[model samples]
Target: MSGLAASERSVRPSSGLSRFAAMFGKELLELVRSLKLIWVPIVFIALGIMQPVTSYYMPVILEKAGNLPDGSVIEIPLPTGAQVMAETLAQFGSLGALVIVLVFMGTVSSERNSGAVSMILVKPVSPASYLVSKWGAMLLLSSLSLLAGYGAAWYYTGFLIEAVAFKAVLSSFLLYELWLLVLLTLTLLLSTALRSAAGAAFAALGAGAVLSLLSNLFPKYAGWLPGALPGFARQAVMGSLEWSSRFGACLVATVMLLAALVLLANILLRRAAAID
Candidate 1:
């Protein structure tokens, strides 16, 4: 009888792993069949090309607009290559946030609404694995989107400018992408917690604004906010290797925020399972 119990226990783990793989594969196939795989990459690619293209010509456009009022000559400083790259990065990065929200809005929330979660759960999958697989999907897509955007920026910037260091450029671009992971994680938290997809998206956006407002309210603690992602990205692009206390603060906050998001998602998923 004891031997039989041990065999049964081992079988349970094997079954659980099988469920995990099934859940992961099903979600991946859904993404592909639904054209999510197509549009997400397309959106980021458009932004990537647009960013560098705009930056390359923006200075020219501004200069053509020429001097301003009071008969004072508007001295347009010649745009440096780094500054131009920064300008493109700024626009690309902002759009990256919106892309994350749109891409993830329906990641889990819609699954819940469409009764798809019920369908999957009936197949012996755990809610924890379900939630995790959704997060994994978001992270995977976001990473690819960032890479496409970075590749575009590199190509455009290289074509227009000389002496661009590949290492610095790639590092800066990657920092922007990592910060975006923070945003993706935040959205996952909201989507999991809220039953409504729209509600989840709005909540994530509102949370972003709140974090921004808090940065101003508690200036000293700004590094700890999600808003700090963009700032850190900027600093990283500029090659600030300084081991400032603020860097440590930003690192800690990013990790903590991600952890909180994961925990919240798991809790909500558990509640969801209990209801089922």
Candidate 2:
């Protein structure tokens, strides 16, 4: 009896780890097999290249255009290396976030719709565990996409500007990943709330747009909201020493969002089981 108990204890940890791994592995396989994963890297790489190239050449292009007539006159300032990096990050990083959201549009909703959620439940997996595994898978994919963007940015920016700070560049890139998680959490909540994949995606996109518009209009004055979080993260990674408030606010909001999603997911799973 003593030997059996000892063996059981030793096996428990390994069993738990294996379960998490199994869940993570299943999601990973699905992610790789999906064509949407292909677009994440491609879009980010394109943005990385375009940002530096555009920054380096925009001034020259404007110079060639020369002075315009009084009615059409507009001054185009030469973009500094930092400014270029910031602009590039904003455009490409946001694009990457959107791509991640779209790719994950069906993460949970599809499973529920296709009756795969029911199948998963029969396999000794709890709904919470399944949702967590789905989140883990999305996080992994987002990390890879961000890495691609970071590598491309480093190569292009290093070539374009000799004095670029590697640490700063990395921080900016990491911030982008956090932003990805924030959006992913928001979408996860929507996926749980909506029965249709299209409905979830549209709801998430609409919420994202509204948050963005509000943040752009209010800046520091805006309350602790999802839209404010990404901006704070971006500013911090960009070495904005004064952006701590924004970063903190974003982090806090992200945590709250995840907590809310956990509650919602549980409710959905209960409802699903009831229906079954």
Candidate 3:
């Protein structure tokens, strides 16, 4: 009987993996059907390209807009490629983050409200699989969008601005991506816990804002928070951050918080399923 039980346990993990893959496929299909696969990347690319172009033409733009005293020359120094890339990331940190939050805010809550989760849960699927599947889909979308955007920015920065180091760009990109992932995880957790999609989005955004404010206000203490990631990412791009001393604590804390969010999401989803 013990051997049989052990065999059953082993089989469960395999079955769970299969279920997760199937669910992840379904989530991807849904995203495609909703036209996210097409437009999200386009938006990211657009945002990416705009930064370098805007930076390159800043003097002209300011001259045209400033309407200074007749013949007043506006000699704005052009930003370096790395600075342009960092500014592009700033755009993503704000508008891009909002787009992502709004897009995924309804990922699980809407399905649960529509009884789709109940239907799916009637099968042998585990709540962890369901939540993880949603997370996987979100991660895929976010990564693709970020890569497209950052790639565009990098190319333009090299062409229009000074060339940035590949290592700096890569490190900054990953660090910024990590920060975005933290926000996405928080949204997913809130979506699983709250019934209203708007509420989830609002709560996630509010939490992010508060964290960022606290990090800015108390940098000495809140340096380990995920909110400090963008600053660290910018510093990396500018070749100023000491990764070993500056990022270690924040990286560990951010990852731990993300894992905790995922676990909480799964548990909340499981309880919701049980209640239904």
Residue-pair clashes per candidate: 0, 0, 0
Order of quality (TM-score): 3, 1, 2
- Distance (Å) between predicted and true CA of 98, model 2? 2.4
- Local accuracy of candidate 3 as per-residue lDDT tens digits, 3-118: 99999987665567778889999999999999998899899999999999999988888878876888787778888787898899999999999998999999999999999999
Best by TM-score: 3
Off by over 4 Å in 1: 1-15, 59-75
Q: What lDDT would each prediction earn against the true structure?
A: 0.71, 0.73, 0.89
Q: Answer with 2 or 3, whichever has the higher TM-score.
A: 3
- In candidate 2, the residue pairs with backbone N, CA or C atoms under 3 Å apart (3 or more residues apart, or in different chains) clash, namely none
* lDDT winner, 1 or 3: 3
What's the TM-score of each model vs. the native?
0.82, 0.81, 0.93
Query: When superposed on Cα atoms, how far off is each prediction in RMSD?
Result: 4.8, 5.0, 4.6
Q: Using lDDT as the measure, which candidate wins?
A: 3
Give every collision pair in model 1: none
